[model samples]
Target: MSLLFVSASRTCRSSFSRQHILLSTSRFQSTQINPEIHQTQNQQTKADYPSSSSSNSSRRYRFYFLSIAAGALIGGAYTFRQSRKYEGLMPEYITNSEQLQRKAMEARPMPPPVTKHITFDEGPRVNFPFKLTLYQYVTCPFCCKVRAYLNYNRIPYDIVEVNSVMRSETKWSIYKKVPILVIENEEIQLNDSSMIISAIESYLRMPTKRFENISKLYQSVVEKDEKGKLSFNYPNKYFLVEPLTNERVDPTKQVQTEKTKDDARDNDATTTTKNVNNQSSPWFFTKFFSKSKSEHKEGLVNIGSGTVTDNETKSITSYNKSSEQYKLERKWREWVDTKFVHTLSPNIYCTLNQSLNTFRWFSQAGDWEQIFPWYQRWIIVYVGAVVMRGVAGRLRKKYNLNDNVRISLYECANEWVKAVGNKNFLGGSQPNLADLNVYGILTAIQGCEAFQDLMSNTKIQPWFERMKHSVEPHFADNRLRATT
Candidate 1:
């Protein structure tokens, strides 16, 4: 996910600029104090004792020497830190991108033949219709969610790396966000993680339906205020539209249900904004997905769970949301989105050193020029580290997180493990959406200190390994399939 962080370099620069004035003021004040002390000592010397002058002189000399020594020590320490090896620092954008691409190309191995399934549980091969191009930040959880969902459904797609700073790739679009998907054949531009997933899923289920018509089902409602400022709202974004009536196939109350849900959502957003930092926008992945996953708690969230008659053929595909299996699915998905995801930011950005290390990993994994440039990498690393360090503190207070963030992470993992209890996955034999979601979120921080600690501390290792084995094959398959 895109972390909402204050610009650390800008903060440091502003602070440095103010230091000059502060230093000048301090020097003038010190001069004023010294003169007063000298005048007082001289008067005392004249009245009481001749030895007072010598004692005052000795004290002044000692104070000057001590100040000099302290300054020298601080200067030496700073010089040592600055002069340390910068050879390992980030390379120029072009060079780094080329190297990374080349390495990926070299390391990628071809998948087995379509006829030859690696595992017995390999689902039926899906022949995707149109080419999909996804623009996203490499480390974004929502982007990862889309990727995981696509891979899980065996859909082939391409990726465009959008510059995190400039975001020039999406400049043409009004909804400025990562995880923008362009369906080439229909020329459809899909935004929002949940909307994208729902639209695509609807298309997949009803392949005979028009792509444009499917896109219309998830259309966002835009309104203008008295000041002419536009506000966009997506209601029942996840519900698939019926083919004939062009209405959302919702199982709940018919009229005004969407409005009620939207109102509740608006209220939640307002509350979250007022309470949480404006930085909460970057955490949209977890919030949106969690809301969708609240189906079990709120009696199903307009998912296509009930049987609907096909207008053209009169065919019906039975889907019962009230089923125990479906309920379990919703439960696990909610747990992953809400509880498990909340632990990530707090633990990964727990401390200054930890945040720095996390950025170092991002510098390696993220797009070279766009996300982490050569010159900007170090600045981002230091600045992002400090920013996240403070952000973690705020998140802890907002979420009521534990004193030790690692404990929170560990507890979350343990909960997942306990839920999986005796089974290989929540899906029993195979990995479910919940399993994939959790695995993908955790995978984002795999190289960081949090992931390592999570593996060592919790009993989630076995299930995590199983998930990796199951999900990785599909990723390799997707990559190799793209080449064809």
Candidate 2:
């Protein structure tokens, strides 16, 4: 029975299933899926989701492009700013150059041939009765020269020794250099050595006779202008004038008192009669009168007699010609400033020595011990000597200078000796400008014991002795002697 039911079900199932499928077809169509739906969904997903490498590459490209643009903008802005600043500064530099050239040309024009005369009032010539006050250092060659010149001329001057380290005290006094000369009751303040000499000459003009020989000596040492005029222009750029307590009377208004021709002839006749009367006296009185007259004439006319008037002496103080002594001193000065000074360098052992000596000479005394107490004195001296020696050696290496400097110096020394030879002064019998000029160099060299030894051992000693003897007589202060 079960087999017969299975067979019958199988045959009926096929038929019945087909009939049911057909019956359910309408319901199935309402819920049926489109064939292109899956394909369209896949296409949208492909457009939205790319491979990881491709998306990363696109993001990196965009970021790189943005960064490059930003960097270029920053660089361009900086360059523009720098160029603008440079353009603004260039014109100022060019203008400054043009201005400097203009000033230099203006300063160097040829001076006029004849300077207009400057006149001053006359009186019982105010015997510039004041002593000059000078602040100086013995070691400074310039100071030594200035002082020696003043002393040689027998100019009334007082000196105040100034330590080199204490230069600040005089910073505002003059042009910040040594040999500052001050004259009382006068507004004159002289700084440069050359200028000081000129001022001295100007003041000496009043008592010219007394300085006649000295004036001549000074005139021999300077260079002259084409017009044969010797003028000393003060190097000071400006000067200050201070008010005087009293208003002095102007003497320019004074009337001249002249003798009439007949009156002058009568006076001459009277003077002759008096002379005749004196001649007729006893032989002893006559001799005394003659001697007195001779002495008076000698006092008025003689050089080195210490009686010549200032006016006579001043006529000789021209700047165009230099004295023989001045010529010699200048040669030495040139050698030192130009040749030896250029050779100094810090590499040599002698450099330390020079540095130490300079420190001692120019620095505070106490400061040396505080800074370099361990440095021996001999060490310091050695260093200084070596430094100079090194400098000399370098100069010898660099240039083939004329060996005549030493010879010329010696010859000058010899001449100076001969001029003052056996006499006490270079002024023949009196101290004069030549002696002053030469002594400046001599005094500078004399400060060093080694230099002194060198001079003494050489042919210079004899000349030095002559100068020493010639200047001794003028050392006494006659005014003080009279008071005593």
Candidate 3:
């Protein structure tokens, strides 16, 4: 049993040793030559040596790819988990390095928005018809839309900031999306932002006891597809609901003549459109057709469709509703929802740094710091930015937007500017639904790089400032009271 082979002189480990070098000439075997190939031809069934070799090689390569992919995922997951230990604190290197000071500053999330309760006695400067409770993520554009409309119109409303991570505030609702405004009086829920505005505006105009009558117009049954996923449909959202009141019945008493109507339409659809291409569907939502439904991921709704009380009010005059000016407003509102909305993701989250900055604004504006633990905030900010960047790329391609992105953004701003023309807003003297829509969407990305660029490079800044001055402190106006 004590047998030993002869080593190369003294040591086999030496490179110059006989054992270290191959004693015989070596050659690689080719699959093209098989010992059995010569024995068998078309006369007999033969194994495909080359084919088998190629398949084996392909399988090995596939294994390598899977291994690398799996390793990367595992490594990323491990890193994320390990990062939880330092949730509130940055690593020493990041804190110490001056190069990463900005990033280090961004690591800390802003505190949640202030929570205030507004009761019925606390009426706004203007008479608001109802007590509304709006459930939203403060940074959501759709939520911002509702806010802008409410503020500009001098309506009183309550704010409930839903947690994007836990979403505990809105868990009671089936239709999960932001900008869910609850009409506290009739126990009714408004889902889409446009639909909410239309319903509320109609109520403000007519003061109907049966609010369900108007809200029901937007009611489309939620359909479950084969995948067991729910899809919400809102057809009448963009249409301005004509209030059924005797107030607008007589077209004969109208102030504008036919020539004035034609002039007004022409003015609303100003020639600024000639300078820009406004046809691209630039909305960032994946389901561009259902942009309202695929809006922000977390929010609230509790639909209580009560019976509509008998209101014998007559329909408005055909003159106002069927007017070209009305048509123009409706068209631009549709444009904002389908086209301008999509441009947001591409611009706001264009780069990782921009995305990070946006999410930081989100964390602060939505008040995520108080809602979730430090780790959740970290995941929401960093991981959410990464995911959103990928989404921005996809949205850019889906909408056929320009690679520069700013071009599409500028075109949209220009189109709106053109529509507004020589007036303060699209509604001539005041902001229309379209003006409010565009302004509100832009407001959500205010602190981001994209917004600064928009302000510096576009002509929309003046209009935006006016809109801001009008809509600022919307949630905390005279309408809101400190409920003890």
The lDDT of model 2 is 0.39
- Write model 1 residue lDDT over 167-216, tens digit each, in one string: 55555554567687777676667777666775665554333335665676
Error of 1 at 26 (Å): 38
- Cα deviation in Å at residue 321, candidate 2? 14
| Weakest 10 consecutive residues of candidate 1 by summed lDDT | 278-287
Per the 3 Å backbone cut-off, how many clashing residue pairs does candidate 1 have? Answer: 2
Q: How many backbone clashes does candidate 2 have?
A: 26
By TM-score, the best candidate is: 3
Better of 1 and 3 by lDDT: 3
In candidate 1, position 384 carries an lDDT of 71
TM-score, each model? Answer: 0.54, 0.38, 0.60
In candidate 3, clashing pairs total: 4
Write the residue-wise lDDT of candidate 3 on 1-484 in tens digits: 0011122222443445433332220111122335444234212212411246778999999999999999999988876665553343334422332222224234422221325454333344434566777888787888888888887776766787766766766665546788777766666677889888876664443334466656655554444443334455676676534323333322111211111222322321221212221221221211121100111112211011111111311233323433556667778888988998888889999899988889999887666666567887898898889999999999999999999998899888888888787788776656777788888889888878888888888888888888787666444433322211
**Predictions: Cα RMSD each:** 20.6, 25.7, 17.3
TM-score, model 2 to reference: 0.38
